[model samples]
Target: MPAADLTRAALSAARVWLVGGGKMGGALLTGWLDHGVAPDNVTVIDPGLDQGPHGVRLAADPAAPLAEGPAPDVLLLAVKPQVMDSVLPAYRALGGGPTVVLSVAAGRLIAGFETAFGPGTPVVRSIPNTPAAVHRGMTVACANGHVTDTARATCEALLGAVGDIAWVTDEALIDAVTAVSGSGPAYVFWLTECMTQAGIDGGLPADLAARIARATVCGAGALMDASPEDPATLRRNVTSPNGTTAAALEVLMQESGGLGPLMSRAVAAATQRSQDLAG
Candidate 1:
């Protein structure tokens, strides 16, 4: 599929204040530029980080004050949740004024931002996985009632600049989202690890086992993406009656102690952790 231009003129026209310049923030800034948003329109406010993209402004904190210039239409909050209380209120001026605050800080509720940024601030809580760095990210977002239609669109555009996005009506669902896509990549990585180990146990050379496992996992994903049929159908197509693949499936598909139940319990635990973190 062709690259999406979800930002439209939203990014180009808005004055953006980015609070973090770490990996995820950097990836998003790069995404805005790649999507043709003018470099001059964005500003970075990470004190610990040095320079940002070529033409964008970078300073230890707000260059002047949050209210000083352009009245930033969007304030991208990509900082850690733990330090948010101390670092976030400083940006309240932006929030109190016009900027729609979009936060990727996991576990921080929209109400938390509302409290810090002051009541009535339009706040968006988002969860983006590690794949965001490669622009294949799966981001899920939910906004407070204060978020205007235009503000929501702009937030979507900014996030869509990096990768695909999905919005949920219920903020509670975010915990489940966190359990699934937010941590899903790590599960995939762990699968590769297990598969590689299994191959080694079967007497394959370590290096060759790693390569085969890696390729098989990635190739399967690619095929899934390209095909119209469901995953179950795809799996059936690769399995022959009483064949090697069937033999493997018999074990893997076992109801009582197989991958299915294991993954279910894993996701449940992760969801509970996410909820705890939110608390």
Candidate 2:
């Protein structure tokens, strides 16, 4: 078997301990199970969580003795950034060993995890969007120096179960990644809202406008995903030289007062906020 296949097989049989059974965590758990990771090999630790998927053990406290068994191969942290500091200490015993700590919390830096888990611990900090619930999200991640090639492959396989994954050697790029892919889904939703409102104003009924707007946005995204052509090429293929799209493009493609500048400002603001949160 190929090395990649062997790594995947290992991950499929690997023991996983998921911290925080929130939206993202649940999504990841579902994805992993779907990708062939045994449900019996996974444990979810969340105080507020009532239950987990069938065959998956649930623990309310990370520090408490586990009726399940020993430490996991991968300890994935999905808690909110606000509660991460308080929650991290409980899992300190699970770290700095064979376990690789993969975190999906925004604004939490790799350095902080190293400080909490010790310098030799392998840590992967990632930012993933909400779309992972449906398994179409984009995730960008970075790892500390302790992570080995095998550990990186394991992280990639786990992350790949949800959606696409990208890595950055320089961890600082994660702030920008958070701004673009992390917050980008909200921007797309807002665009759908704007399109719906505009359609309503242009004589369509509110419900009709909303439905069409939502469908158009989703359809366009699907096309972008399926097409071999670049987005610019696909966009140009739809737009005529002197047509409705061109007319709209005239306003939107303006040098200064256009979507380009507006989106740049938005991304910049989000990037700054990400940095501030990390601090």
Candidate 3:
């Protein structure tokens, strides 16, 4: 099978109302605009945000209300999870219509959105990682049974603006998705930190070590992204007979307590945490 071309999807005609304008919201809005979505077609509702993408309207919250004016084709919820319960009800008025609510907020579930929007309403729960800011995000989304094919496609189009998207049929897998990709960036950053410190310990200057660590991680990631071969194949390609890379991999790939086992445990812990939060 071939990879789907998410960028080819259209959001040019959809009326979008974003309910938050913080980091993630800004990333999504910027990516959409960069992909040529009309500025006038988008509106942002965030009380704290005094500005947003050029030509996009910024509406104040609570008193001004999201339900006001014409309803949007998609109403995106990008607010903090802690405040979701307090803020979601207000957006309910915008639902039960043509609007398909798409949530990028971690830990918020589709059933919760359906409850707020009333039963049988289209809702999409997505977990988009921080790479979205760079327009290379990987988003995993799943929709409620109420969501039609058209609504799902619109959600995909809207999200695709930020980067690639993976549509899941089972919502249960979303917690794992969140743990893997949603929290994956932090793990990669931590790896960079560890590598940099190791280099400094090995007598390299602090500045040089840091730069090398950053570049190596980033360059390797770029290679992995562009390559058709799997990561294991790439790793093998870099390993020479009785080489330094092989020696390092010996320590890192040890069966019992190596990167593979440790990463499995780490992802499992993150996945469990996500499931707990969802519960």
Models 1 onward score TM values of 0.94, 0.96, 0.95
How much is the lDDT of residue 201 in candidate 2?
95
Q: Write the per-residue lDDT of candidate 1 for residues 50-162, one digit (tens) a residue.
A: 76678998878775646468777888888888888888857766666568989998899988888888877888999998888988888999988888988887888888878
Tell me the lDDT of candidate 1: 0.87
> How high is the lDDT of residue 254 in model 1?
92
lDDT for position 42 in model 2: 88
Predictions in order: lDDT = 0.87, 0.89, 0.87
lDDT of 2 at 141: 89
Top-TM-score candidate index = 2
* Candidate number with the higher TM-score (2 or 3): 2
Off by over 4 Å in 2: 2-7, 65-68
Query: What are the clash counts of all predictions, listed in order?
Result: 0, 0, 0
Off by over 4 Å in 1: 1-6, 63-67
Tens digits of lDDT, candidate 2, 108-189: 9999998998868999999989999999989998988889888888888888888999999999999999999999999999
Among all candidates shown, the one with the greatest lDDT: 2
